[model samples]
Target: MQSQSVPRRWLSLLAVPLFLAACGTPESPPPEDAVVRVVTPYTVRSLDPIKQGLWSPEWGYGELLMRATDDGRVEPWLLESLEPESPTSWQLRLRPNIRFANGNPLTAAGLAAVVDRHLAENARVGESLPGADVQVLDDRTLRLTTARPVANLPHLLADEQGISVFDAAATEPSGDIYTGPFRVRSLSAEELVLERNPNYWGGEVRLDEARIRFVPDPQARVLAVRSGEADIALYPPTEALAQFTNGSGPSVAVAAQPLQHLRAIPNLRKAPMNDLAARQAFALGVDYRQLAEDVLGVPYRAPDGLFPDVVDYALPTQRTDAAEAARVLDAAGWAPGPDGIRQRDGVRLAVTVLTYGSQPDTRTVAVAIQSQLRPLGMEVTIASVDDNYAAMRDPAGWDVGLSFDGTLGYTYDPIGPLRSFLTSGAQRNFGGVADPELDTLVAEMEATPDEAARRPLLERAQQIIAANRYVVIVAQRSSPAIVAETFAGYLPSSVLHHISAQT
Candidate 1:
């Protein structure tokens, strides 16, 4: 379903900000500098909203012209309306009286400039969508033309990866001007302070000010919540659930999010993994249920497929059978070696796993997998690296990679993640997993305009991956937050971070 108001509203800016502000009446306005403190494990890689802010914007400093609604439907935020002129071209109508935090009027030309800069720097968006071009017709109207019929253009513009509009004249030290409900007062690597945007076109800004502190350490995050140093703790150590629920400070809030899938990528270019039978045996062998329930803690479900349950075409949960796994390994000519590790022609079944050190959960998962595979005659070596991608590039460096694989595509479509993993020359395709059948399905899904029509194709693509065991699906993760009882209006989706006071 589409939001009708946004599709037509893009045509005219004509006194919109004034009309909306005057007609809308807020029941209660959030107090000035109310200061809701939030501590999260995520790091803001860049202070620039256009770069890092669009994804997490942990401090809630910037706003995109459009955003995905609670249900993953596209809705206009800064833009008054968005409509497609053609399969390749889209027109965006600006809202009048929209100003940045610095009191600068956000013009169409300025917005276009920022988008142009982003396009120049990153070739992925344009290449992925094809002929992605932006043009400003006037102060109120802007046009975007893709090389092909991309039905999800609005979702792309408002995507979490980037595409947030910032002031073209913004500097590194001063940061960029934002048009969101909250404006950045000051932001350091360690902490960020945001005040209400008085000029917000969305009517009364409910949050007057918010303090977001970066606490990457899970233990530190839990401590911040218990000590009342933070009003909310995001993605703390899964084990810390007891501390919050056991009358510490706040209650744990859990939302089932299939957006981020924890999967193991077997290097397709490497030795044992190059054989499809070995990869399939690896997938069937692991005790994924035990890993999710016992090791990863509660609220996280074992992943059935790459996409989460939210997507219409997500595959149903598969049954795990160790006997079948062992049979496949034996059939593949792998026999138990001297130390019980599988071997074939003097080669041992030893695999190296790489993961990011920042996430405590990843380490716990790796260890659990290691334990589970030992009985199956597999020797797993864990290497926690600062950069998982860096390790992935070296074919000889690692055999299996454990990480979240579907976050980027969660907001809109599965094509983004699918293309990244399956595309022949795609940068993020760590294992060099290339399958012609999978590529054809992905291309068809991408080209198809109707979501309903694309469903079957997407399902088929996922089925192919499952059957071939190109990647090992471990568990689908839910983003859990520990929040104080007083906090309210925090929408628990893959996207959205800002909150309102209970009162």
Candidate 2:
């Protein structure tokens, strides 16, 4: 999923202007001439840096690296250059020109401090996978030696959560401070105000300040964009219904690919379902194309593999096969019953899938699945469970867990997710699935340093997952945002927000 479309005229030339926010002091009204006022949905879930998920672009709050984008690749933002001394070691050329918002020059010590702090900590993994033990080469350069083969390093360096180097003097050992484009100027129960970084080395930010107003309800998020209360609204699940300016003006909602991969993780721990046929029946019975396009109005193509466009090794699987599904179920002794639900021996083939949170048009899709599968003798049930997806992982609570696999493989290395499904992976037994074959593939993927040799193993592993029916992935699609036509400078890459500069 790379965008071949070049930056449009509106995206490149427009400078979205800003006025002094009312929240500022009388004397310090926000700079009349600041950067774009981007109104996103999420607020400061936690200022405690390491715990933040990719969801936290709150990178706006931190600074240590400068961002430079080249088409699809992310080069060093804080460091001027990088010289690999060896496979395990490299010397980083620190940026002398980069400065923290607090006016501290981005020296080797600051870079070293950022890396060293995470040695004992898990430092957020977003896409880069893991942090390493960094050795200070000198005041201007540092050497890093990874504990293992960290192929995702380059992508990680660009991760706003992990790679945005932090200023040492700004925080206590607790690890919270200002680093990126803005700092939290004020916070009340309802709103958060952010101010520009005078020492910001990135470039000129057009807004004097941005007021991040929180809107929890999905409807309110849409309303904010429609009413003009918010200059930019995020995660507008109801974008289709709302009018847009892209072609139609203010009558629209705005956002970009925020997250995708809404999926169903079938619990392989139970019998019958633990049995392959039951799972296959579930996979083949539901129609995802209808769910994505007609029901949701937001369209997406069926993915050939777990990772569609961005991840190269993911190969496509066979399309939904009702005949195969029926055959598999019959072979498993689940024959159609009087009421359409299947019954095997003495058991009725009833499975419950837990879901929570509404996005765009999920209710309709879930309902359609239930209706479609009933005739197959499989009774499918959908329930809302937003607060805890782990409950679906609970052996006693569900037969299938319905949730999006947003990061899936993109979150870290392919292994970061591969390890999760392994017999010993975290978020364990999401489907309570354990295959010796999958375990072996993931193991090789983790230990094998060479990606060339790992491609087949990775490909085969994805096939095993689909073949095993541990999951029935709906159409693979990333989330989309309708950015205001006036917004620009943001280049969306395999890595989102590599350069979300509002020009």
lDDT of 2: 0.58
- lDDT tens per residue, model 1, 326-398: 8988998999987899999888888888879766678888888888888888889999989888888888878
Best by TM-score: 1
Q: Judged by lDDT, which candidate is best? A: 1
Cα deviation of 17 in candidate 1 (Å)? 32
Worst 10 residues of 1 by lDDT: 1-10
Q: What's the TM for model 2? A: 0.80
State residue 172's C-alpha deviation in candidate 2, in Å.
4.7
Model 1, 149: alpha-carbon shift in Å? 4.7
Question: How do all models score by TM-score?
Answer: 0.84, 0.80
